[model samples]
Target chain A: AQTVTQSQPEMSVQEAETVTLSCTYDTSESDYYLFWYKQPPSRQMILVIRQEAYKQQNATENRFSVNFQKAAKSFSLKISDSQLGDAAMYFCAYRSAFRGGSEKLVFGKGTKLTVNP
Target chain B: EAGVAQSPRYKIIEKRQSVAFWCNPISGHATLYWYQQILGQGPKLLIQFQNNGVVDDSQLPKDRFSAERLKGVDSTLKIQPAKLEDSAVYLCASSLRAPSNTGELFFGEGSRLTVL
Candidate 1:
């Protein structure tokens, strides 16, 4: 069984600043995928960024990026030039890539981010 | 492209009552998922379907919960004799088949349930 953990329950960042949310996971599989999703008050979950387990380079999308350390099983999300719209609950998810395996996504608790103006 | 669709944006029911939710996945998407999200927590997988067949239901409380996807396009999740713990937002999501595409899933605005 694979489990994801988000240690930070709440985080705050000033507008125009940067912040990071930490996440770790335990998995026996060597190949998998990691993702960060944002859930606003609307309750719609939106993808933020994704990182492949085999990739050494981190994944970046606009102001969102991930610091993926495979050896440590750590995948952290970084938000730069934070804005008020970034205030939301962020979830870290994992899925296995093995063929004919369970593809159910395992998610961490969440980190509620507040961006102050 | 139209995203996944879920009905009954909000539902309220008493304990021991029955409730159901409907979902329509994106066109051409072969995989569908149902997730339960408690307040202040992440979404938990309740069931996963691949083309009208269940791929995973290990975490689902089968004794009270039931879900089905017919014709590999539409899905429904039902809870009989609901409990207070069943109060949570139910999210529906869809994605392309795995191994052929990334594991990214498109989610619908969840259906909120309030069990009294």
Candidate 2:
């Protein structure tokens, strides 16, 4: 069984600054996918960024990026030039890539991010 | 493109009552998932369907919860004799492909449930 862990329960970042949310997972599969999702008060979950385990380079989307360390089973999200809209609960998710396997996504307890103005 | 659709945006029921939620996945999406998100926690997978067949439902409480995707297009999740612990937001998501493909899921605005 794969499990995700988000160690930071709450985090705050000043507007125009940067912040990072930490996440770790336990999985024996050699290939998989990692994702960071943002959920606002509306309760809609939105994809922030994604990283493939086979890729050495990190995935970046605008001000969002991920630091994926496969060996350490660590995948962290970094937000640059943070804005008030970035204030939300962030969750880390994982899924296996093995064919004909259980395709359920496992999620970690979220990190509440507060972007201060 | 229209995203995943879920109905009954909010539902309130007493313990031992019954509640049901409906979902319509995006057109051409073959994979659909139902997740439960308790307040202050991440979404947990309750069931997964590939077309009309269930791919995974290990986390679902079969004794009280039941879900079905008929015609491989629309889905419904029902809880009978609901409990306080079943009070959570039910989220429906869809994806174009399955395992071994890019992991991207489009989620619908969840249906919030309040069990008294």
Give the TM-score, chain B only, in order for the candidates. Answer: 0.98, 0.96
Per-residue error for A42 in candidate 1, Å, reads 2.2
The 10-residue segment with the lowest total lDDT in model 2 chain A: A96-105
Q: Pick the candidate with the highest DockQ.
A: 1
Model 1 captures what fraction of native contacts? 0.85
Q: Say which docking band candidate 1 falls in.
A: high
Candidate 1 has an interface RMSD (Å) of: 1.0
Predicted structure with the largest TM-score when compared to the true one: 1
Interface RMSD of each: 1.0, 1.2
Report the lDDT tens digits of candidate 1 across residue range B1-116.
89889999999999999999999999999999999999888899999999999999988999999999989999999999899999999999999996667889999998999999
Query: lDDT tens string, model 1, A29-110?
Result: 9999999999988768999999999999999999999999999999999999999999999999999989899777899999
Give DockQ: model 1: 0.84
User: What's the distance in Å from true for residue A70, model 1?
Assistant: 0.5
Per-model lDDT: 0.94, 0.93
- Candidate 1 segments exceeding 4 Å error: none
Residue-level lDDT tens digits of model 2 in B1-116: 88889999999999999999999999999999999999888899999999999999988999999999999999999999899999999999998775334788889998999999
Clashing pairs in 2: none
